[model samples]
Target: MFDSMDEERPTASEPAVRRSRSLFEKHGLRATRQRIGLAKLLFSKGNRHVTADALAVEAHAARMTASLATVYNVLNLFAQVGLIRSLAIEGTKTIFDTNTSDHGHFFFEDTGEVCDIATDEIKFAGDLEPPEGYEIVAVDVVVRLRPKSGSVPFSA
Candidate 1:
């Protein structure tokens, strides 16, 4: 569980609080109470994929007063600041990933959960050249997967 630093001001002595503050400062964002609480929840569990709705449920379970709209806004902001990576899947559905490194993912279609795939796991046959006057950015590969016949789909 995250520390109950919502009511009180964060101090340097508290490692988690300090980390949260440092994250915001490093990303040029103001460490508001709501954002700090959400950050603690989002990051404390280590790297993983999360949706705003799922995070809202976790926040509610953790007794956080963040609304769904607030959760969505904060998640978008975090993605925009490069604190997290947003994966656009299934049309408008988005999953926020904590690990911002260069990597692909295994998208489970049945369960709608995403898993990371290392850069070495996938290899291109030939040189992937970009268009004229354009440099290649990151290659986002989302390999969608589904359970075969008689096999059960993994639960999220």
Candidate 2:
């Protein structure tokens, strides 16, 4: 397991290492060994979403032993620093997005995949009024999709 770890370990000249280090420092987070390792993986993945459990799997595959709790803690910290965006879906899975900008996603119910939806491809209308003295800071648009009805192979 660790053979891959040794083979692919990030070198000093790698941009991911430098960028993740700068990101952590910018967020006032101490660059610990584990945090650096996780940061490399997270920031290097480009614009994508991931869950703590899934990240743990990647770490395990790399022969790294950071626990799930540690992954969650690091993820929370990353979000707090505006390094990632967190989304709660279906009251179950929480996804962490590497893209920290304003954008929407398309959630596929069958495959559990989330893909980016370009802002220009969508539009909103009507009122967004809120209760008195309250304000809405941000609104996220998530389009949920399912297979076409005709594609169903069986019925309950």
Candidate 3:
């Protein structure tokens, strides 16, 4: 039986180190200490969405050294290499999602939390029409949610 929690999270286990190294190497990024530490923190937690500020806070809490700018750069790099998905929502807010699969998201306006919606949960009934020389690559659906009037506020 596996005793470590990392064992339960395959991508967070020992092999994750190898995976992260290879992923960075394949994309021509050096597996620096800060990069590896940030990668572990991002993947160790289950699928979730976080902003660069939030990641920086997590890094500080975990005692992993990384600047907010470095966090942003690493996140952008990861997104570029298909390691994570970037969601630009609520005007100037950008959230990084650890789950890179093609799926929809539920954005809670009040709490600024993002939850994944299964790919099949949303169905595109009508066909999409692209411009003269353009093709439809991907359609991202983000359902914004707000509590109804008189509803209880989100706790924690």
- How many steric overlaps are in each model, in order? 0, 0, 0
The 10 consecutive residues of candidate 1 with the worst lDDT sum are 1-10
Cα RMSD for candidates in order: 6.3, 7.9, 5.5
For residues 18-102, what per-residue lDDT tens digits would candidate 3 score against the true structure? Answer: 8668767866889988888898888777787899999999999999889999999999988887677888998877899877655
Q: What is the lDDT of residue 42 in candidate 3?
A: 87
Question: Which residue runs of candidate 2 sit more than 4 Å off their true CA positions?
Answer: 1-15, 123-136, 152-156
- Sort every candidate by TM-score, greatest first: 1, 3, 2
Looking at model 1, residue 47 earns an lDDT score of 73
Top-TM-score structure, candidate number: 1
Instruction: State candidate 2's TM-score.
Output: 0.77
Candidate 3: which stretches are off by over 4 Å? Answer: 1-15, 124-126, 153-156
Residue 66's lDDT in candidate 2: 97
| 37-115: candidate 2 lDDT, tens digit per residue | 8877775555678999988888888777799999999998977766678888768788988765567788888888887
Q: Which of the numbered candidates is closest to the native, going by highest lDDT?
A: 1
- Order of models, best lDDT first: 1, 3, 2
Candidates' C-alpha lDDT: 0.81, 0.73, 0.78
- By TM-score, is 1 or 3 better? 1
Q: Residue 98 deviation, candidate 2, in Å? A: 0.5
Estimate candidate 1's alpha-carbon lDDT, on a 0 to 1 scale: 0.81
Clashes of 3: 0
